[model samples]
Target: MTSLPPQEFTSVARAEAPLDENRGFACHVLIIGGGASGTLMALHLLNASPDMRVTVIEKSALLGCGIAYSTTDPGHLLNTRVHNMSAYPDRPEHFRDWLRQSGMAPGATDESFVGRQIYGRYLNDLIARERDLPEVSRLRCVKDECLRLEETPKAVIAHLGDGTCIRGDRAILATGHAVPVQSHAVLTSGWDFTPPADPGQPVVIIGTGLSMIDHLITLLRNGHRGTITCVSRRGLLPQVHTETKPLAISRGHVPLGAPVSAILHWMRGLAADAERQGGTWRDAVDGIRAHVSAIWRAWPEAERRRFLRHAASFWEVHRHRVPPDSARWLQEARDRGQLRILRGRFEEATMGEDGLIAVRIRTSGGERVLPAGRAVDCRGIRRDPAKDSAPVIQDLLARGQSRLDPLKLGIDTNEWAQVLLADGRPSRRLFAIGPCARGAAWEITAIPDIRVQCAELARHLHAIEAQDPVGVSRG
Candidate 1:
């Protein structure tokens, strides 16, 4: 068994299941994955019902910080502003207030964008404070990976990697980003940037999205002198964040269920109108941020595929933005000939005779090979979860309890965040949120979207629990 780490500002304390012979009886909620999504779900459940109990099963000792927020780099500022990144949508200033009192960012404002590590600290503080609450001491943070889940007549049993089994009334799949864990040779992951032996040696990145920008920021801030090349189909970069009021848009005005082509034309007109009215396209895009999921839900599978084929890249560049300072650094790097953007598609990577990584990419004209000291796959968030997702997800897929959506963007899920079985039926006991259920919502990767989903799911679960009067074993 991997012994749980002692609790600290960053580490989470673990609680094992009771060793009673009847331990298979019902518990309240088993929230798998202790990243931001799981933590939010737990908190909302606790608030929804006075006696609700939550057990969070997470492999990593870092409680609330997942791969995204676990970065130790000081240069990684959050793409979203503090005003909109709160854990609670009703309390828009919750994170801002925490930042002020936590002593980490005493001077942070609503508009200020801080380091991702700092936000991770904020999430950790929430968990720590909740743990200290004796009156509501129902949340259990377990440091173990859930291998698989089995459904019973009354409860859901989760089998952990350490050979421990825990039963709950419900199991939530909050494993945020499908982290790519397997090792590779020629190409490295964008998540973990390993510094090359020679900083002067050229580096090639395989995507021009936000992830690529993150690599660039890290390299530039660390004083890397090599010429960096970023390659993608269109070489489109995320729009830079600027101070402008988001245009107020009504849901009725949005053309939900429209074709991808129609939606594109409508959005372009909206942006043009925003510019004519003294604002920029950013304001117009931001206006429809909350309605993105609704628009996505309205679309059928054919339209959704059309979006992925044609408009997904364009929408991402507009929706997911880069912070001001990072954008400035990137532009300056380009102006100084330290950065190069290539419009092409990454083909493959192989070791070259000169001991450098040779990255092959196909352009409009032809294919070419670029030799570099290191090549990193900065292919943004959409990873093949079938091969690279966390073990629990893989086990679910294999067991026919869950399957990847038709697009294979993520696990198949209904609108309510319920994991769909391979036979096209929703599982009553198993639920997935965040990136694991990406097929359900287009804009759910952001904190604002995820927190809302968590709150709503908790309420739904609470209602179901209230209907079932069966209580869990106290022992």
Candidate 2:
């Protein structure tokens, strides 16, 4: 587990070896995005094949944090319990063990929710440890944004922002999510925040989901005693998690051919029956989660769209539950009259004089005008790859090398996550994981689910690499 010589960690331009010819380069895999998915993928691949070469290109200088875990605000806490936050399923206590070994409290078993920055540090430390592995000597990480990707006869060429290109036999797009979108008027008017404004001034948050919660925490931590308003169509906050009993429902018991509405009706009835038998609905939901993927697969595209349009928000709020502490804090904030949650549609927004923004919101009661000192858009990432602004994704789309999913969930792919082309054919050497594969597999975002996918994908990549013995040079 010795460190590679400093020279070997130099920039791509100054590396000892020159870029391979357009003919092709022999490498195990080239992974894009050094966030959780990409880093874990690299670790899995390296662990499977010590002789294989793996390179991770990260847009941000920091690796492993990605968008969800990158916040520095102490108030931005993880919503899940520490015990269940392990990056690997097989290692159920991995995160808890790491916490203890790092000199934190021992035998801490409460559903404790810690700061997001602390979680980021844990992820970074894990990556550092993995990099020290003897097998990881074959792993190379590049700190550059990928601008374009082209699949050649022999290899895939990844063009970086710095105008340099690298080729690999296989490529993986773990690009993760994009930044939240802001209103066009806000951008054009150059309405940016200068903190420490009057505490009583009003502020509007664009989305009432988890991101909005983060903004609320930030505003409070900044000592802003202002009236904070979070507006969304459904005006739903994340559901709070609670201890529950287990159920006897198995995957085979759930009918697959029924319409989604019918399924929901059946599920509701089952939950009611469970409640009559002295069990909570939480038990039923947990039972359904065990076979959610199967249910999702059984649904037709129309049914899926119906669910998205009618029930996605409700599902999200329940599926992504909040930790008890954060839930209490939010409740307290509301009870104190400092925070307001409005359910409505965004009508329009205008800039006013003296650092003020007027937002017109439309609710069932009618239009209401609210003045805000500052506005923050926290709607979360755009999931449609066709509308994505990332250069690498755009390049692939232009060349017909990759196609967007029918539902625009992200890129099109098979169950194995092999990226499909315009002609609806899966590429042998190009695979995708994480949020990018949502179209192919609905439930792939959570760490536990993603780790399993990475493990399985790693096995596939390793089998392929074994057949082709590509020798990677070590420093």
Best by lDDT: 1
Model 1 C-alpha lDDT per residue in residues 1-475, reported as the tens digit of each score:
1112234355664553472223332247889999888888887887777767788888888878888887767788899999988888889999999989876678989999998877777787787777767653777777889999998767788998889888777789999887665355778888876567789999999889888888898888777999899999999998899997788999999999899899889889989999999999988999988789999999999999999998898899989898998899889999999899999988889898899988898999899998899898888665688987888889889989999998898888887788889998888788899987898897788888999999998777676665663421110
TM-score versus the correct structure, for each prediction: 0.94, 0.88
lDDT of 2 by residue, 24-106 (tens): 32354789888878877877777666555777888776778787766656667777778767777677787887777764435
- For candidate 1, the TM-score is 0.94
Question: When superposed on Cα atoms, how far off is each prediction in RMSD?
Answer: 4.2, 5.6
For each candidate in the order shown, give its overall lDDT on alpha carbons: 0.82, 0.72
Candidate 2 yields a Cα-based lDDT of 0.72
